[model samples]
Target: MYFISTSSPDEYSTKVDRMIGENMDLTRDLEFWMSKLPACLRALPIIYLSIPGSHNSFTSNISGGSIVSLDSPKILQNLEWIYCIRHIMANWTKNQNVAVKEQLKAGIRYFDLRVSAKSRENNLYFCHGMYSCKVEPVLNEISTFLETHSKEVVILDFQHFYGFTQQTHGKLMQMLLKTYGTKLLPYSDHMDHLSLDYMTSQFSYQVITVYRSDAARFGQPLFWPSASFPTPWANTIDHNALFNFLDDKIKDRKDNVGFITQIVLTPTLTDILFNSCTTLEQKLAIDFEDLRTGWISKQTPGRRGVNIVIGDFIDLSDNLFTKTVINLNLKLLRDLPKRMTSPIN
Candidate 1:
């Protein structure tokens, strides 16, 4: 029953705007917020820190020309031959509205990347329903961001892969190794012992690459296996159901690993077919703004609380989604004294 706010989307947006206006000091530094976090909080395990992320982090460039990805529903793929249907698919499939660099600058530390290898093509691409920009350029963008932001850490979650062979996975993994090089944090059994301070100061590790395949197990230690970051999808469009699902997931979250709470609504075929004229942002993201914020504001950051909270259209209301998630870490400050005395394990 945490969702008590009954405000309309416009009313909630206005309220958020006012809140941001009032807290200009905090919002202004979002570009480097991680680097500016209180030292005590930085010393805590990253699993216990609240981080901001984006769902489908590379769909900003998907357009009418983009092809329906193999990972999309079979029905979507079959009907994509129709011109208008492809555009409609793009409308519903695009989950993010900004580029990777912009997301990084907006304090998004976790990136939910779903990659796919194009048939007869050597390059890999990010996709939801339609293929987005090539993966290399986006990876370059993240590496560039990390170069300038020395103390900041980013989690690159390779959530899904499609049409990739063993050789293709090798190519993609090589691309990652070349792009990140020494910046990557190798997988460790004691992830709970890793803190921002330990990562940045002790080892200078800035990027944690999570690959969700068995290939990651035998490959470079830099490619963390899916078990390291347990991201369970609620896969529901109902707001109440999404909230309840998150509550259970958070309560059951395991220690010593990253947990992702996808604060998003999945559109059903019927919902999309009935509202073909509207974009997912309009039909789902904007409509759920009030409830999403209400739920986010009430959450805290810890082993059993929200670790990484991701959402669609993260640039909405002046990057309100990222700001709200990042601000949750401030709650940890209240228990700084007690935490300092306690053992990290």
Candidate 2:
């Protein structure tokens, strides 16, 4: 079984310091925490389950030059790569850098995907203002992860759609249905004990798809509306305020719907230009300990019980925050023997 030592912050601190000095090995494989859960805890409703996710998960590949058009000249590309501009550009773009499969291994069960169609060729790509890699390959990676880790379930939330005609949305939905097929879980009115157990069983299929557009729903029960999944926007530069905003939402959240605690800082124009030297990695590193002890640790006792906790740089510092969230789930397991056996509606 996978074991995570929660006793020391130094393990993460040292890793982050090394990353800044050398290569960033955020994708280094770790133990599969979800699959290691006790049987009773595994039987709980996924909406009540604690899940770690990435905000703009597909944007790890986005750089300043990549966000710009391919037609741009070499000179422009070179200038954009300069330290200040790159850091500034990093603010708006590049929330994550680790690939999807790596994130899966690191115990991230939820993926916050933004999709866009590129051209008449009908190619769909992952996007956040500007585009990144194509969508299908990433989905393929997720599929591969699911295949290997049958006991583990994942949440695919297509929260944003851009550069798409109405027809494109339908096409995208068709593509997803075809690709995922029966593996996708249909919507359930009540996340009772039986349904939860069935969904998480090794023999049963898994995937909770939350699609933003109604055009793409295709009357399929698998697709959930935005209202059922609340992913509050983090439009603030103040790190503390961002957490406070999420804290307020968490306090007021409805038990029926799933919640996404977006732990990220949205840098304003001033933060971008003035604080150009600091990378997203550095910011996350600085805030990591405080967030773990002050924010995430305090969340387990709340009514909602922390559904999906998303953040930028999930794979950073060797999956520090991801492990923290997963450990929170593990912490829930001790009480599960009683809860799981009881008839939960």
Q: Which one wins on lDDT?
A: 1
- Winner by TM-score: 1
lDDT of 1 by residue, 1-345 (tens): 012133576654454454444444444588888787655567788998889999999999988778999898788788878989988988999998899888888988899999998888888999998899999988998888888999999999998899988888999999999999999998897677788989998888999999998876884888888888888899899999999999999999988788899999998888999999989999889989888989999998886899999999999999988888888876665444334423222
- Please give the lDDT score for candidate 2: 0.67
Clashing pairs in 1: none
Q: After superposition, how far is residue 304 of candidate 1 from its true place, in Å?
A: 1.1
lDDT of each: 0.84, 0.67
Error of 2 at 284 (Å): 5.5
TM-score for candidate 1, residues paired by index? 0.90
Angstrom error of the Cα, residue 214, model 2: value is 2.1
TM-score to true structure, per model:
0.90, 0.79
